[model samples]
Target: MSSLKHSHLYSYHAANSRLASFAGYDMPLWYKGISNEHMAVRTAAGLFDVSHMGRFSIKGRDANSFIDHMIPTNLVKVADGGAAYSVLCDDNAGIMDDILVYRFSSDDFIIVVNAANIDKDYGWFKQHLDGYQATMIDETQSIALLALQGPKAKAIIQSLTAEDVGNIKRFTHRRVALSGVDALISRTGYTGEDGFEIFVPDCHVSRPLQAEKVWSQILSDFATWGVLPCGLGARDTLRLEAGLCLYGQDIDGSTNPFEANLAWLVHMDKGDFVGRKALMELKDHETRKRIGISMEVGGIPRHGCEVLVKSEYVGRVTSGSFSPLLRKGIAMGYVAERYTGEGTAVEVSIRGKEWPATVKNPPFYDPKLYGWKRVA
Candidate 1:
């Protein structure tokens, strides 16, 4: 394989992490350790270098109209400076990628997408822009993204800026100065925690130096706040415990929002959007549903493990891990609709042996114990 592209934080990760190739980027798999980083984000704060995710700016007279027809969610419902989580879909309602749309105005917005799908998503956007007057600019390489997450996230971030981060509210954003860098701070995260995702622009100019400077400043400022530098390994386990879907693992080209238990993102009533017709048709005919499962026996479940119902193969695990917070194996997978109810019994094949498991509605961790609710 060819050498992987490196993020602006490559130097820092190289010095501190066990590196691995992911989505064409050389990313950190772990720093101190997965379990250690996971708990740090759960109890205190953790900083994640998520600059690899694709970032785009869409602006034009017809931006809102074009965006409304592209995703399932109602863009009109999102006020200025607010964010909405939605998915891009093919004509058949199959998910292309889940994305977060940040509305700066009716004619201006920013989209953050999974790194692996950047080119594909950019193509999709261009293909459908034939009649729209919007201009989509790929800003992926021009910015560095960092996620400051956990219970102490707000406190740490607030100390750096005069802006009241406490008033940001969830799913909202503001342009502010962090230390000395101008940044767009959003009250959003994937770890189901009260946190902020900071976007620092002009990263491509100075290369790694600009990114490294900001990253170092944050860590140094909060050195005593128990903020650990996290990696993708902990990110996976944390998101799993929160029951959040991973792009390729939990939801992908073959999965639709309905089957993935993300029907809430679809605004059926908001007339006319790509995949609306197909999604409407599949709404009542979903054969399988995504559900959470927790192991009763001690064993870690992995992706592609068979899920059994009464000794019959019912489904396969899409994402699983040994949840550090729960002290047991937890997973999310698609199973027959009949077996999706909470308290349903099932068995997961772990290394050719069946382990007792039970189905439950996600998130596996209680919102009150962790996530946005915990900090709110």
Candidate 2:
């Protein structure tokens, strides 16, 4: 068997989790079952060990200019301490990866990417560094990330730090001393909740010990507050309910921003970027579009299930799950552009049976009721 990399919190997960392999890492798939963990985050708060994601630190006099030239978003316009979601694409306009760019200053920034695309994304950045004077350093191994999410996330996190975490707005971040250890806290998450992603330095000589301390401290402090330690199983379900796209599934090298309903990330008016020219030319000619399908029948939709319109196959599901909050099957997939309108009727072929569905704007759960929109 191939050896798997372990995160700083591996020991904690091993003692209480059902371990599984994910992106070369030994990760926890679930602890108290997916449904229980899912509900915890929906109603209370949950902590996620997301250290498997890649973190890169970019610094140089030309960092801002270099980033603007690399991704499809206008990173230069993002204020300091703000983050922007963007797509990295090849010259042919195919998405390389969907990433979050955090701007600390004009010459300093951080790029967070999917774990599986780390090496490829780093190489892509280096290959385009001919004239740019930016320094890129992979910090994935040096950082341990924790995500505290859900309706009660703010209160749980606020109790641990004296940095006024409640004041941090979405897409913004700050560097503060968390539990006497320096950490980067960002108001961002994948679970569609009011949450914070904490970045703790874990590569020092003390190594995982420091990370474990922080993890244990959080659990001890928030256990009575209904904060459960979540695993990837719950994470997937929550993101699916929020209609968030997963890399390698909902999007891949064969898909572009326009086709994935992410055209908002592409800034054509901001000047030339890697795939700007090709994207601009083909933006209007896209035939398929990403849409949400909510099952109206009793069947559960799964990835690779056939999507049909008018009894004819149109596309396939990329991600799907039964939402714990909504108690219904929700899925996201690419379909013929004509069938992408909200309320359009469609069918999903599951287990050789056709189940009626509707094309609705995703977020099977209402944001105001469960997400960041609910303040306090």
The candidate scoring highest on lDDT is 1
RMSD of each: 1.3, 1.4
- Residue-by-residue lDDT tens digits, candidate 2, 1-376: 7598887688889999999999888999999999989988888889999988899999999999999999989886689999988889998899889999999999999999998899999999989878988999998888888898888887866777787887789999998887777888899999988788988865532277766776788788878877789999999999998889899999998899999999889888898889888898888899999999999978889999999987799999999888887888999999999999999999999999999999989787776677777545
lDDT of 1 by residue, 228-277 (tens): 99999999998898889999999998999999999999989999999999
Among all candidates shown, the one with the greatest TM-score: 1
User: Could you tell me the TM-score of candidate 2?
Assistant: 0.97
User: Could you tally the backbone clashes for each prediction?
Assistant: 1, 0
Residue 43 of model 1 has an lDDT of 89
Q: Which ranges of candidate 1 are over 4 A from the true structure?
A: none
Clashing pairs in 2: none
Task: Tell me the whole-model lDDT of each prediction, alpha carbons only.
Answer: 0.91, 0.88
Instruction: Candidate 2: list runs displaced more than 4 Å.
Output: 202-206
Task: Give every collision pair in model 1.
Answer: 192-371
